[model samples]
Target: MKRLLIACETIRNEVELALKNRAVEIETIWMANTLHDSPDRLRDALQAEINKSEAAYDEILFAYGNCGNGLLGLKSEKAILVIPKYGDCIEILLSETDNLERIRTTTYFLTQGWLNGEKTLDIEYEYNLKKYGERRAKMIMNIMFKHYKNLMLIDTGAFNVEAALPRVKDIGELIGLDVVISQGSISPLEKLVSGQWDEKFCVIPPGHPTDYDDFLGISLSKP
Candidate 1:
């Protein structure tokens, strides 16, 4: 079946890795990672893409989680919509890990794809430092990261985790959080691409808009 995969660029590396060697006839559209900052905008952007491409594909896959309800109203008039059953990309990547609930509550996760995004933590820090001055920037950062005790750098095997550590460590120091490394899986993405839409995914039929109820009962915790 012809498929269109619309995904956040924040997980571009993982998505690409998941599609490698796959026999499926799929096309991909990568949306800006920064769009995640505004759920409303993300919703609008995704809807626009779906409207434009729905008629041409047998199925449309979203490499995203609920994303603060960004996917709430998205629907395809002519194609099935498949999405991960998680709160966000972080949850999707760490889906196979044990203690996921505890890890999400106390840790802020990062990946190379995330670090390379336009609105990465370091970029935000620099912007704040420039606009609000160093003192205020530090204060703002501290407040923003107060809930996180550790900055987890997840190695999804799509990029060099070793090379990213220095930058991750610097960001952790800037936010007064400890830096830790963990392995992340792209199995969820792989499953999506390979049509393994099991319990970990939400499969919506044509003309059926995704609802908040679709995500209910999924164990998700936002960091």
Candidate 2:
């Protein structure tokens, strides 16, 4: 049996789902910095965790973002990173005027297909396509389409789509893709090698708070 470390940008719901249905023993690191804004604090915090359990896992896998702490000297034997592209496009398609329930169903189907690595033949299949249409949906689809075009599906590593948006949107206001594209880059292969890869131990303490959620607990399992 191969031991693997799965480092995530936020919660490990997707990975946990995968683990429940797979055979591999997955050790997850549920990083609290979903937005990747507080590099200094996140770096300091993860380094401390690495120090305590530096001999339990064989490789590291980043479910989302770049795992900024990788640059902080964490050790790992091997690492895999999963980046999910695409937003809630179905919501954009369903005209609030359209039969709200049916539109919701269509939107849910499309988004779920995208999430589960399935392809949608026509991007505008059940969408209104006009009146409610805008370039935002197209932009999102183009990026997501290009990202998954030729990639092989890896283990399901999850991220907080809603949470990471603000900082990314802020970065977008800054320098755009040339800089933000690397937001989820992986690094520091050796420092993340703390082998204590238990899915139960993925959460870290001293989390952050946002207007988005009340008392954001950083632990893997919600408090």
Candidate 3:
């Protein structure tokens, strides 16, 4: 059966890596990660894409999380829709159940995709700098990042480390946060792409409309 993987460009590396490793014969549609800036717009865009595939695919998988609740109400009529049942990609990166909460608390996670995605804090920093001047921009940035104590880079082994490491480190420096590099596993993405929809995923069968409640539950996979 033909499948379509719809996802933000942010996880392109990890998703592609998983697909390549699994050798899944699914076609991918890359969407701009900037859509998150406006949740309603993102929902509309994703729904439009999903509607387009109602006749083309037997199964359609979303390579995304709840995001800022942007993907709250998406549904499909002809194909089963599947997605990770988590708040954001941070959970997908740190897909381990045992240490999930331990590692994610007060942490602002980073990935190669996040670094390149639009409408991010870093992007806003530059915008604030130009629009509000150094003083006001610094205050705004501080307000934005005050809750985050660590800037973690999820080393998913999906891309070249030599290049990505420095970028995360530099971002940490610019943001004045402690930089941490952790070994992340693509096992989650690998499992998702290969149809191992365990407790960690939300499986919305065909003909069912998705709801916000679909994002709730114990979705951590067992070790």
- Per-prediction TM-score, please? 0.93, 0.30, 0.88
Instruction: Report RMSD (Å) for each prediction in the order shown.
Output: 2.3, 17.5, 3.9
- lDDT (Cα atoms) of all candidates against the true structure: 0.89, 0.32, 0.80
lDDT of 1 at 6: 95
Ranking by TM-score: 1, 3, 2
Give the per-residue lDDT digits (tens) of candidate 3, residues 1-223.
6788897798889999999999886788988987877878988999999999878988888888777777777888888888888777777777764576765666778788887776665777789899999899889877877877888878888877668777677777767789887788778788788999998788888888777567767343222
Q: Which candidate, 2 or 3, has the higher lDDT?
A: 3
Q: Which scores greater on TM-score, model 1 or model 3?
A: 1
Q: Point out the worst 10-residue segment of candidate 3 by lDDT.
A: 214-223
Name the lDDT of candidate 1: 0.89
Off by over 4 Å in 1: 21-25, 219-223
CA displacement after TM-score superposition, residue 39 of candidate 2 (Å): 1.8
lDDT of 1 by residue, 80-165 (tens): 99999898998889887998888888899899988888888889999999999999999999999899999999999889999999
> Residue 190 of model 3: what lDDT?
85
Q: Under the 3 Å rule for N, CA and C atoms, how many clashes does model 3 have?
A: 1
- Residue pair clashes in candidate 1: none
How far residue 188's Cα lies from its native spot in candidate 1, in Å, is: 0.7
Clashes of each: 0, 18, 1
Q: Report the lDDT tens digits of candidate 2 across residue range 1-223.
A: 2344534433244445445444445565565533345555655555555444445533334343223323223333222212221111122122123454443332222122233221232334224235346465455445544423121111122345445445434432322221121112111211123232332112222221111122122112221
Q: Give the residue spans of candidate 2 off by over 4 A.
A: 1-6, 9-11, 67-72, 76-223
